[model samples]
Target: MSEVYGWEFSDGPGDHFAVTADHLFAGIWSRPELDLRERRLLLIGALTAQGQFDVAEIQLGAALRNGEFTADQLREMALFLCHYVGWPAGTALDGVVGKVVDQQRKSEQANKTK
Candidate 1:
């Protein structure tokens, strides 16, 4: 996991929670019909539909970091959601997505400078 993300899963309650969550997550991810990208899109849609923008933002950030999608792709998804799910949810996400994507872009630029 550290190979994909710069951080490692810490030990203790958080680790236990992560392990359980990953087990459940892996069941869906392991399905032959859905590749990682497809699963990510499904998760994105579900999160949006359920009004779980915070968790959706986290998943979007991870997906961006992992090169699963581009910033443009995320923006497009948000726009689509605005159309289908209503403007309120998409409006609510504006700051969240902006902050995350801005931070990620800065991080990427800093890494390049190093």
Candidate 2:
């Protein structure tokens, strides 16, 4: 019962979709048998295939936090996308990955200083 946007599925349609999506994502993330690295890579590939850049970006961050992928891994994935999904899709992800990499670098630098 963590509150996500203060809305519950039992309330309404919008809430139902949001809650269901959240639960599904939680289930995927919490599957005990799947290794974190495998789960993250699958999620990244799925999101990329679906052309969901925003969600892919979020997943990329999660993957990085979970130690499933490094910034180089993400860049390589983007390049791979360029070959398979076309340059436009890969180009779009470039900015998202850059931002994530920058933020991660800053966070690491701050931690090192601490």
Candidate 3:
């Protein structure tokens, strides 16, 4: 089976949405013309462009964990976003991506220790 995170949110008030999103991501999102990495990048860029920092943070971490994007590539994407989305939005995205990278690194280290 494919790995999916964020369904951990399924025990709370948002369970319905979390399950629905899981289904979409594992099922329909995989049948698209675009590849997984490209789709991830699109979602990341869209979320960042809209200044959806919290949601983007989760996705950024997932993207990194899934090997869809490298930390350097994410930073480069943020710079690309800056030109189109304005400085403030891009700067906010940078902060979120940085946090997600740190979280990903810690998660990797923790897994290694286990």
Candidate 4:
């Protein structure tokens, strides 16, 4: 969750969501059935269906950062899924992909300069 969402969470017992997330990370995500890349694709598709581009962008950015997807591939997925999701959602996804790719490239460049 932190890797994909750039989130920090308390390990305290009081944080129900944090505890649940930890369990999910340790259990569900560790299953060998579907790799993280495949799971990310599913999640992105679902998010697109719901017009949840903000969260989708987070997933897209993480996918790029983790080398799970190339910028071009992400863009292509957006274009392809737009047909299933509708024009407006697809357009939003395309724009988000562009933004995430640009941000990722900028971050990479900054790292190289250091």
> Which is the leading candidate under TM-score?
4
Per TM-score, what order, best first?
Answer: 4, 1, 3, 2
lDDT of 1 at 2: 42
Clashing pairs in 4: none
Tell me the tens digit of each residue's lDDT in model 3 across 50-105.
Answer: 88988888778877877888999999988899998899988899988889888888
Q: Can you give the TM-score per candidate against the true fold?
A: 0.79, 0.69, 0.78, 0.87
| Residue 109 lDDT in candidate 4 | 98
At residue 13, candidate 2 shows an lDDT of 67
Candidate 4 residue runs with Cα over 4 Å from true position:
2-13
User: What's the lDDT for all of these models?
Assistant: 0.75, 0.72, 0.79, 0.87
Candidate 2 per-residue lDDT over residues 2-62, each given as its tens digit: 2211223343366776677667646755677986677767767667767898988777776
Residues 1-114 of candidate 4 have per-residue lDDT tens digits of: 665454554575668877788788777776889998998999999999999999998899889988889999999999998899998999899999999999999999999999
Sort by lDDT, best first: 4, 3, 1, 2
Clashes of each: 0, 0, 0, 0
Candidate number of the best lDDT: 4
Judged by whole-model lDDT over C-alpha atoms, candidate 2 comes out at 0.72
Once fitted onto the true fold, the runs of candidate 3 whose alpha carbons sit more than 4 angstroms away are: 1-19
Candidate 1 lDDT (Cα, 0 to 1): 0.75
